[model samples]
Target chain A: MRITNFLFDKVGKWSKQFSNLPDRYIKRAMEQVYWRNPKGIQYKPNAVVKRKKYHFSVHRPWTGEFRQENSPGRLHPKVFVEPIKEWSFFRGDRVEILVGKDKGKQGIIKQIFQERNWVIVEGLNCKLKQIGDDKEFSGVYIQEEKPLLVTTDVKLVDPSDLTATTIEWRFTEDGDKVRVSTRTGRIIPIPASVEETIDYKTKATYLEQPKDTKADAVTEITFEPKLATFEMDIMEKMGIKDDRVPPKSFWY
Target chain B: MANLRVMCKLLKNLNISNVKAHSIPSDRRYKNWGAQEVKSGRSWKKEELRLKSNSDLHKYVLLKERNMLLTMEEEAKAQIQLFPSPERIDKVEDSMENLESVIRERNVAYHKLETGRTGERPYKMSKNAFGLRYRHEMSEYTMPKHMNKDWYEEFRSYKHDRYTEQFLLKYREKSYVSKRRQQIRDFNHVIHLLNRFPDMDMQALKEQYPNVDIEKAKASRKYGGHFAPK
Candidate 1:
């Protein structure tokens, strides 16, 4: 127990000194150390001490073992939170402002920040920004667009009549998923790169040529046969004499 | 001769009339009657509306109004009692809006044919509080901005005061500090990555972090470790 405590203290102090080191390097070092002295050390189990009505839980009891077996270090807070899904709107989609000062105004979506559910529409919401000193530039004011518009404040515009329309997910007769305008009941074409899966049902079917028919056509064509004495005649004209020798006869 | 006369009279009495049914269409709300007395079609397209006469358009409007009233009554009944899908109200409202817009378009077209002007609201160039110019729909009874005393007073109060300016200054300073801290963190992370991966793609790293000076990061002592300088 004294030797195990001493080893734990030494490793703990060394690890504490290099706490700021990158995770991968520390993990590599720990793996090497673990393999070098596999049976020399053991991890101390977590202890729960209870008093009256209170409970105290202690983890990583000086044996230099991680709290979680597989995980090398502490888990990040972000890992516990699920990431936000992507919004429906994309850059270059025509949208109408639903509320605020620019209500009923239509513009193309210039940018989208899915993380914050914010979008920037081109030439829709504008604000005045004070630029330069009033004394130096004589009250130079530049009209700038607002940083972002909330995603909920904008609605997609139907391309048919350029009016605000709600979208509904629907399946086509060919079993392909498509977006349909709730107002007009018209199918809205899926924008490129937005939907990853290709609909094979919508693809045109080509008539395949019969394999037997192609083979029959090839067999129908006739080929002229070459004379077997043609090569010998050619060799004789070239003055190359053939020397005939029997088997098992020695010749230089 | 009497039997033939009686048969002809019976056939005449059994003759089917061509008069269409006047009953309202049955929907999912009606449990007993699933068959529709009258066939209902989709919303009127622009081309179809253009081909329709004024009287025809008016008749369509009346029919839509009746359907909308019936839907409203059904929705009210459903609201009083819990219904499985409350979205039926929204669907009814959307169809009503579409019908009304189609009617409005035909009305505008008819008015334009009679008069030399479009029967739509006119827009005027207006400026907001930020002094940004925009086209605003003109109101029927709105006074001029300069003439309205209440509006002028409100506009005067809308300007940023001294406290607002101070708050903005402090907010900008806080945002700048946060941005600077983010940059420092990114730089340190890049340095750590370089120390761990000596053969890492330099170009990709540079592209990923444009703000960090790659040369400066390479020259830093923290990235050099315990090795002597060559």
Candidate 2:
């Protein structure tokens, strides 16, 4: 009711909004409960028993730098934050990173940040080169390749929720895949069947692992058996020649 | 409860309720805003709603809850009547849409009287539109205990007579006129749009138009719904 003027001042469209309210609904609400000083409680003479109508403003708990703070840019891709903790049931789970220099690198996201958007991985092979004037050079003008953020170096770990929440768990261990509650850190486990197959070592359960898998098979071979196999494209039956891909993709 | 369920059904039909606004107290999937198991007693200050039977307190809470619903609905209606431009109206529409969600929670909680309430409901101790943050309808403030010489001295030093009311008035006067001016402009726009586009989809128009009532606009003298007789 008080903001009617504030609403009205923003006239263009909001003006129409308030004008349409039924007068009946817009009427000032009557105070249902009335507080009165009883005759017995009345002061004998100049004793002032005051009633202060206390009021306060409710501010949002969060105040931080937001992407939405400056402009109404196109919506960013939906960020899914999966936890990688000390005792996770799943293994070698990968999360798509969306921010920073090594963004879009599908490293198996190792850890999550509740307060910030920092994450850690086994090792990221990155190269950073310094570019500037050679006037104040110590030895010679040259660019240095360096790893920007290491396991020790703090990287920006983005969170899905703008208003940071704790975590929520569905169930206890070995139940559902545990997920942090939106704000609170209560674990919500995803239901897992007892019949679910366990991966021992580098057990390749191929759900169409691409060329990336070819490299992985040699480097990180495990003892576990391939749980399931499928020949999606029976190249032999189709009589199609599996030609070599461009060397630029795998090599230089 | 039945009425609220019907409202939910309506929202369901509208394809608006992507998130469930109502949930049972025991339901784990939805983190209800501590609605069920409302510990009734006094208004944060333990004198008003306390010392009474549970039924009286229920009645009190219900009345306040209903007023909140009324305000939301009124605001929604006014938004359409005042802001007719698509973009500005879109802003109002977006806000109204969110308000609908807030209403869903309120409506569900109000209806689920038997379920009881838990935790703090939707309200926060909010400041009014004015730059001041005043404690609102639902606040959890208790008078300080252990009345000592310090309490008497501190409280007695400063007078607090009608500060909240005084604060409210100052803001009201400041915001009052411009709001009315906005209302007039919107009403005119609604009148113009209807006169221009008579066969408009009334409901869609209602959703998009804030300042003008499509039906009323058509019925106005300038826009007399003029067309060939059917």
Candidate 3:
């Protein structure tokens, strides 16, 4: 497989779920193809030379910062990201800090970088930095919350008791998967806000754009199975008669 | 200047809006030309397209949208400005793909029910001049293979030759070297991963690099950390 396909796999499902963009769009926006095989037969057919590795930091792959970080010929060290079996953390998830000054303090998950198993809590694990500091003036300080590893730096909070607890994925009698708090054995429901994206809060609330097909129109089924191929059906509907047979031809 | 102004007046009165530019009738421009982003819904799902009739599929006016997007993208490139919501192109393309697939499915279903064969284009796995196997998509010709001198001239069926024999030897050697290098690289990468993340998920590592022997990688000299043993 190509490195582009490999990098595409690195992008976590839950991490990009909030974008609400199609997978194809994300792949198109993020990939930097330096060279590709032109339209002709060659020794190496369909060969492409593109950036092999990327520095996946706090910056999203589709952002300007990510492009800058992964600028041509500027290679970063290999990142050893632990492979996760299943992603449980999501946007709007309440989690407690485990290894910082804000330890035991709970905050909602504001952003996630599943590439590195990192998540940014709403207002926790912050570090102050001074920007544009010069001799003539003391620069203003800004607090930025850094990402924390979901494995060691944070734990999900059980909504039932409002305390940090380990959770296990369990299926109910109805066959719906739910995250159950192991400490209290109570079902911590996934929030409705999980479906929130940059475009719209929910699918129902999405405002229809000018080019968008109406919901009712899309749902209306007009298909009736016919004993003809697509082209045949279309020609019949258009009232085009073709009785002349094609000339004899051979296939090698 | 006065003559130019008069010409402009005449042109305005003539109503040149109907004039086609490069075969495109509409003024090729995006609706949200100056906006920060162009918001749109996701691509039409295959399930949704399957419900549409043949005429509805034929009436799908996606070509104009594609043309407009290409024009806007070119303009943005020329001006060095960010093309807002580039994803619209991808969405359109994805929807087009879904539409075509849905149409193909219907056609295939009809053909299979009638002819007891997949109505797809016929192809066969055949060797090329270089002795490499590729799917040869069969095409219609006016005459049989033996009689079609033009086809034979163009294709030149594979034949054993001294030059080709030597070429194949070197090509196979090159391929083998690259394949070996790739295996070594994968092994080294796995070792480095283990060194950095000792407690990493083994299943994931195995899944990612299925070719690398996990036990062999662990037993390598470079596997452990460079720390003093307690």
Candidate 4:
């Protein structure tokens, strides 16, 4: 049993080494063989070949394993930008419809489909759809926002004057980049929540402030009763002597 | 008389040095009283915007916003008188977008200067179900992919089912048959050419159809045509 175990271990190690032959060494050996006989021995063309060289006329039976290389009318997948372009209009932004039957109508953007370049404007360009027969709410006609308008059909309304305006980018003297109105030259302030995330300078400036250390310094002053006499005189003239007290007509 | 009135109105408001206090009306503000006319300037190009100072850009943006508002107002008031131009809104929106993107570019540059890294969200290359790679912005998550129970379940769902494997097998078979048919067509065309042009360059024929053995094709009965001995 001991001899058999030893023989098995030796065979296993030999097999592992044989399997792990270096590919580089094998490649180098091939190169040596090619160098020894650069122009390898040529063979004479066989006069009566058993098999045909070209299979042009021969039709091979279809094997289910082989796939067709060219599927008829197979279209290449089209690559498109996900959001089309960087969208400037956001939900709730007041916009005026620029085209279609609802042209000149104003409404806030309700939903944005950036990929499709479509936007649904609230309370504008709506269509009426009759609800199907139902137990509680049958025959009701509901007004629904129409199919989304292409982003190009809507123009953003400036918050300052509730007007549509073109925007331009400009850097302030302090090196802050802000959106500016092209028409009025007004600096369009970013929304507070969005500004908080992007404006790191503001936070850094706050951090750099000197800590207050005048907690011990305290002062107090009292007003004399004479100072209150003018107020009392006015109240007396109006027939209300006690101004501090609530009037009978006063309801809490 | 309408032209004179419009000219006078424009002249009155044409203080270039000082920014206009009131918004311009979109209606016949630029038009002659009796005639329909299209009058507007082109959008501000990036190069033009870059040439101007920060104050100047601000003024331009403000001016555009005011013009858009006035145009909208005019359209609203003259609902029966005139039809609003459809492209006007698109042009204004486009100008605004270009302006904002330029501002964002500057912001990114400034952020890079102040900080070592860009302030924009980080994205990584991710493959979709179709094996096409796309840039996916990374989001903050409490747990890692392997550790997240929901993510693990979703990953398992992405595995190919038996039906999918069967479909793939059929698709592959179809592809192979189409490829074989194309090769056969090419081979037949080459043989027909050889039969007609017996003196055709053998090297050129080999080069044209690399897979088709020209020597073997010449020896074949098909290349000899009907007149040659079978």
A91-172 per-residue lDDT for model 2 (tens digits) = 2333334445656454543332221123344344344445564777744344322222222233222134323233433554
Which candidate number would show the highest DockQ if scored against the true structure?
3
Candidate 4 lDDT over residue span A1-252, tens digit each = 222112211212211121222223222222211122233221221222221111111111111111121122323332121112234555556678887778887887655544334667888887888978678767879998864544357776667787777666689999997777788888766543221211122222322111111111101111122222233434554577553864333110
Instruction: Please provide, for model 4 over B144-211, each residue's C-alpha lDDT reduced to its tens digit, 9 standing for 90 to 100.
Output: 56566765454333246676567557767777887677667656666777775665556646654666
State the weakest 10-residue window (summed lDDT) of model 3 chain B: B6-15
- Cα deviation at A84, candidate 3, in Å, is 1.7
Q: Kindly give the number of clashing pairs for every candidate.
A: 0, 73, 0, 26
A93 Cα displacement, candidate 1 (Å): 32
Quantify all predictions' global Cα lDDT against the true fold: 0.46, 0.33, 0.78, 0.45
Better of 1 and 2 by DockQ: 2
Off by over 4 Å in 4: A1-252, B1-35, B54-87, B128-133, B139-230
Cα error, residue A228 of model 1, in Å, equals: 88
DockQ of each: 0.01, 0.02, 0.28, 0.01
Q: Model 2: residues >4 Å from true position, as ranges?
A: A1-252, B1-133, B136-167, B175-178, B209-211, B219-230
Q: Which 10-residue window in model 3 chain A sums to the lowest lDDT?
A: A1-10
Provide the global lDDT of candidate 3 against the true structure: 0.78
Over A147-234, each residue of candidate 3 has an lDDT whose tens digit, in order, gives 9999789999999889999888899999999999999999988888888888667666666565566665666678897889989988
Cα RMSD (angstroms) for every candidate in the order listed: 39.5, 31.5, 8.8, 34.2
